[model samples]
Target chain A: MLVLELMVVIFLASIVAGVIGSLVGLGGGVVVIPILTIGLGVDIHYAIGASIVSVIATSSGAAATYVKDKMTNLRVGMFLELATTTGAIIGALIAAYVSSIALELVFGVILLLSLIPLVRKIGEDIPVTPELVGLSKKLELTGSYVETDGSTVNYNATRPAQGLAGMLVAGLISGLLGIGSGTFKVLSMDLAMKLPMKVSTTTSNFMIGVTAAASAGIYFVRGDVDPIIVAPVALGILFGASLGAKALPRAKNPTVRKIFAIVLAIAGAEMVLRALGI
Target chain B: MSLGNPDSMNNVISKVLRYGVLLSAAVIVLGAALLAARDAFSPSASLLHYDPNQIPHGPFPVTFSSLTAGLATGSPDAIIELGVLLLLATPVSRVLFSVFLFAAEHNRAYVYITATVLTLLLFSMLVTPYIPVFGG
Candidate 1:
């Protein structure tokens, strides 16, 4: 393909990936990586580089809206960031030692594992009552946000130590795989920390960019980030994520989630197969 | 809104993030335009060609000095790299801003927390590259 044609194709594909990613609550990296590597035959390292950059774009873009809505617990997000950033650095260091095939295999497994929470709908909708809140108070991991119905909801996070541990793993996966690892983050905030679902999701969104950025610098230094590849991917994902955010309120369909899940599963399996030389 | 309200802090941070993303996107689009124009003039250039072991045609600027040097030469890739760097820095800036926000609120605990997070981010992004094992 001509250079322009190739860039246009990658750009268009990234837009679709961004839309699906935001709609399904998966960040752009998971979808973008598969398209770049498995679909376009780009080298995994470059694909990862592009994917991680786009991850920052989409996350920051979406986070702006979420933060404005006051759903994101800024305190919790920043505090947990302490763990995620450290984990991201470690993960990036480890990425340097791992082979492309190994990276692909791990990416495939993480992709599949990420779906489990969405499949089971593990995030709870019930408002947390701020019980068992000693750690949250001590650490100030509590906040209030206005609900859609013009009511205020107050909540406190429980299990900070465990939450930080989960965030570390989330950051590790994000750095190594060049994805946001939002599922793990939501799990940590929702299941481990007992934060409300809205807080968990938005806070997870808030933190994703920082976690990805922590490792993106390393990728850039390693020369994995090609300007030509990342420019289109970043712009495409940013555009698509904005569209997805606007569409989300009206298009919260279970069927859409199911279809996206199946597509991601096939993509993940293909990645695993490719890594295994199948 | 009062400074005590959590919403006030979010309002400032959110604006910063939104503008940061927009600025980076605009910069990237400008870079892409330059690249397309260059390719249009020289039809034989395969800018999209990828090789894992080698950079495509020109030097891919990864360091700040190289980025500046490339920009001085009007290199489109350097502009794009600058955009990417700006995007990566957006979240880091947010964390940094949070330190100030917490300090303004007289929230000593969170001030310390945000500062620690910022230090970790800088350490990973800036300091780690100097370490032999982590850099490569």
Candidate 2:
């Protein structure tokens, strides 16, 4: 009976997650985990496991559309995998054995820390000026995305010498915290690598699922993949993401924006508490 | 990056080549090590450090160093994790790149109003990683 009720809740939440995930470049998992853990009395570990899976599902679903439009740079995506996957697996293994407590604590800190930029509302958007060697050339990385006027904004990266270092940090953070480091990665690409904001965002979304999957694999083997725990949260996040995305263009006020920082704060606290076994 | 002419293109490509080589090497040698320094696999270190009798007065390991230890699984280099992140980088970068182009064309009203809001939305993440300064 409880399971039946939970299923309904999960379905509803999935819709919510879908909406929220789209609104925020970070996948629904990051949002869903906290709500499920703190608001609904679910376990943190289960929240992460489910969150990552949902990340993959949502990313792939959304990525298909972006890729068809030629927004994604496949070679660049493939190249960075060298660092992200390695970091993810290591991060996950650490989650399982090394002070599970610390994992929980860090998870919370990361979520809360995200608010710095969120609240600051970074307004810096520089043009793509060539600084370092252009990695785009070696990888044949170039694409033209549709601008607001429906005209195309065509650009390429200069080896974005700054991007790789940023990516490594992004990978470590994502693997360490189990939240998609999409926000961080995008910032790095834009500011450090001088890539266009759009490319940085799209590429980070493409990378999160795989990174999450790496840590998730370890959790699964260690018996942390609790479906009961996952079911409600996954469904909730998926739903949230769907809602968030749909609301992106239509929401008159972007209602989700103001509360976003608050949500992050709560999630952070939840992670710290869980890590401490509170 | 003079693309309208063939000779200029060649010159541009060579310059890019030289930069890419120097940059990649720097990243591999410095960035990889700086970030990966904390991302290594050291299981028992965190656990050993987690003496419940210590300061936080909790059963869990709540320190930043311990949390870092948690990220360090058995192996420092985990291929699967790195691959996933690399793959994710594509879509994320694309979106960020797209946003900038869109924002560039906006007026102050649009920039202050819509673009700012959008970027906030863009970087909004759900999970966190900080130690709670105080109990609720």
Candidate 3:
């Protein structure tokens, strides 16, 4: 129970969290929260603080590679940020009025519902190219990335209005719960926007940093971001996320989709349990 | 990926993010190392047992003056906080830089869009603390 021993244990646990989080675009908070609160017996506030920092770490660490490899759709990410950031601010303002229990139940249901497409797409490696909407063409929300086979797969984002709306809700929940809500972001891109799984995961990874940063300052000011906790969590997540990032480019889309579905299932179940006060 | 094109913007921003994370990690490692060295001489209990009033709990409140003062004395906590501060700042700086990237592309529409995002970010981080509803 010495301070040195605590740091080493937490640092080791965070590496596993980082790997799974970056692989599925969950930002690793899901893994970090339980490890800190349940395993380390850290206060929930401090755990949240550490998780938020890990979210940023996972985003930046994984994104550094995704962006350079052109897997992240930069234009799509920036365009969507307009909605997510606005939604986040609004969610924060209205959080005082909203019942967190109801919100959790609703989020849980939505996440479970999002699993349908992933389940259906289990057999497909890449998403079939969809007809581009006029708005997509006008916005130029299209890009291409090279697959493991060295062939470039071109893709376009459809249903911009709906996609943006989903991002708004994602941001709202993120601010409301003080969680990254990366599941919703990936769902928006993968389902509503009809983007490829690789792009959705990487783009979600790319954007979560900004989304989490919006609330991270508040946590820091509140003194919840203990340096002893955050330091190991951040470093461990960065290392793990870098490993995940390297593997993702060569990872199959269907495999990534399956991993996302499994993680979503776990997160959704946890939300339901928390809402029920279990 | 033509120069000044939106595609090229990714390359620039990627490098920024990479270096930002690396720099913060370096600072954090230094602080953790310092903490380990300090603890080796005068051992403390696990973080869970630290006094709630101390940095291990919810009382490491950060401010510009306090941060600078602590850094001047080589406080491990402040150094780690600075690293966290840098980590938080990376995405904000990326957004700010994106505005310039958009402007360079001569894409007025995106410039406005990116700028709006940046404004919202700043508002949430810097302005909301004044609003009592947010528990600031």
Per-candidate clash tally: 0, 95, 0
TM-score, per-candidate, Cα-based: 0.87, 0.55, 0.95
Each prediction's Cα RMSD? 3.3, 16.6, 2.0
- lDDT string for model 2 (B77-98, tens) is 2222232223323333433433
Model 2 ranges with Cα > 4 A deviation = A93-121, A124-128, A131-134, A158-161, A229-278, B1-136
Interface RMSD of each: 2.4, 17.2, 2.3
lDDT, ranked from best to worst = 3, 1, 2
Top-lDDT candidate index: 3
The total of clashing pairs for model 3 equals 0
Worst 10 contiguous positions by lDDT, candidate 3 chain A: A1-10
**For residues B10-117, what per-residue lDDT tens digits would candidate 3 score against the true structure?**
888898899999999999999999978877766434443444334455335377788898899898889999999999999998999889888888888888888998
True contacts kept of each: 0.81, 0.00, 0.64
For model 3 chain B, give the 10-residue run with minimal summed lDDT. B44-53
Candidate 3 has what TM-score? 0.95
Residue A219 in model 3: lDDT: 79
- Candidate 1, residues A1-278: lDDT per residue as tens digits? 55667688889988887776555445677677767776776777788888888778777877787787776788889889989988888887886787857876876787678678657753235544767557677877888776555667778788899999998988887767667777678667766787766567668768888888887776788788987678889888888877865655443234434655575576578668878988
Which docking category, incorrect, acceptable, medium or high, applies to candidate 1? medium
Candidate 2 CAPRI-style tier = incorrect
| Highest-scoring model, DockQ | 1
